[model samples]
Target: MFQQFSLTHVQFMLTGLGWTIGLAMIALIGGSIAGSAIALMRVSVNPVISRLAQFYIFVVQGTPLLVTLFIAYFGATYLGISVQPIVAIAVAFSFYAAAFLGDIWRGAIQSVPKGQREGAHALGLGRADTLIHIIVPQAVRIAIPPTVGFFVQLIKNTSLASVVGIVELTRTAQIVSNATFKPLEVYMTAAAFYFLVCFPLTLVSRGLEKRLKS
Candidate 1:
């Protein structure tokens, strides 16, 4: 039975792991674009724009990823639109990631000196121009560590997508374990694979944090 842990299962699991990474990368890219827009809106002087951004962040952060997944799956159906599990998961996580990323970036933007903004104003830079030319570059430095750290969280969160029938790493482990009746070995391997993907990102984020401090 122990020998049932064959190379075939290993290859299958590796393929699933690749899907997990691919999904995560998609979420990161999509989330970053959406989240950046939300972050900027959050800091907008216009009350309505700021409120809208705040509301979006509030709803997303307040909901669990699982609940969000259900909404994405069934919600689309109710609206007469068919959605795939992968698309649903990607959409759910993009909004989910956006809320947190927006908040993190907002904090980073706020950390910049108020005097810097005034100085930019003195140089005749408009709000958009000032943010682009002055504030964003500085905020990027502060945001990198947390943003990278969040990638690990995002990767782990991909496991949640398995519930929706997405054939990512966790789902692959479940299928293999059910077949081989070796939950311990199969799941342990899955754990190792997750750690392999995430641990280096952890170290890299820490390194960036240390460098930022210096």
Candidate 2:
């Protein structure tokens, strides 16, 4: 029997929305760690190291996000290790986000003018010092917009956690819709919630891009 969409249903969805945000934050922080390492290795002068990084990024980025999730969940089960939904989702999204973020940041770092490096070399700064004080700062400015834009996608991708039994936004909406028999209302509400979370990021990213350009 279909029940009415009640206030409680809305509240439940709100709780799930919180989970979605939390998952995205996890992905961001963890991915940033993994991504920095990947970016550094990708740009390493060592051909072997660079090739390895390239392979890692290619394999991970080429895989479907859902397949990553499945590996985090079911793959762990096959290995006889239990995995919680949040942990699995975090691990999956972290590696997934790392590939793209690393690629984005690598491009940003390389996009810096070669003259900047020449000037740093002329100043007697070591490679590490040049990167820390000069190259990184400039690359960071270039990277901010794309990084934030990727965050928007990360937030949306949290919906995939539903398949793993995480009560994130999409899963919560599905539950509510099933009970109330109101898929349209529940899904629209979910879409509104996602827009509320993501639209501000788009604005901020665009603003930063213009500021950087100027």
Candidate 3:
């Protein structure tokens, strides 16, 4: 018997949507912390540190995210280490997000005018002081649009957590579709939930870009 897609189903999916938000938050926070370090290392004066950071970014960017997730989730078990689904997801997403975010931030940092660094040097500002006080503030404006855009992409990418047995929004949609046998309705609702979450961020990104420009 086909079950009607009802309020109860919507509520169940809402619970899943909450988990989706939670996962995205985890990925973003972890990614940002690691990415900041990667960005700094990429711009390091030391050739060795910069090259190592470059290699890390290259490898992560070249590998597919799905493969990374599988390695994080299943590889742990193979190593006789037990881990929760969320833990593995967090690690994998952070690692994957760091590569791109690092590159995005590197470009932002480098985009600051060369004359600004020269001016800082003329004032006897140390490299660290110049970066912290002069360069970073300007780089932040350049970074915001692309960072927020990547965040929106990250939120949608959380759907991949389903492959690791995460009961996030997409997984809930799958369950609901199976039970009600209404994939179109169930999936359409899931897409709406994603749009509702992501669309606001898009508007915020644009607003910030305009405000920063002005």
Best-matching candidate per TM-score: 2
lDDT of 1 at 53: 96
Model 2 bad stretches (over 4 Å): none
Q: How do the residues 1-214 of candidate 2 rate in per-residue lDDT, one tens digit apiece?
A: 9889988999999999999999999999999999999999888889999899899999998899999998888888899988776787799999999999999999999999999999999999999998889999999999999999999999999999999899999999999999999999999999999999999999999999999989
Ranking by TM-score: 2, 3, 1
* Residue pairs in candidate 2 whose N, alpha carbon or C atoms collide under 3 angstroms: none
Q: Which residue pairs show backbone clashes in model 1? A: none
Each model's RMSD to truth, in Å? 1.4, 0.8, 1.0
The candidate, 1 or 3, that scores higher on lDDT is 3
Off by over 4 Å in 3: none
What are the TM-scores, per candidate, against the unseen true structure? 0.96, 0.98, 0.97
* Worst window of 10 by summed lDDT in candidate 1: 1-10
Model 2 scores a C-alpha lDDT of 0.94
**Model 3, residue 150: displacement in angstroms?**
0.7
lDDT of 1 by residue, 6-68 (tens): 779989999999999988888888899999999999999999999999999999898898999
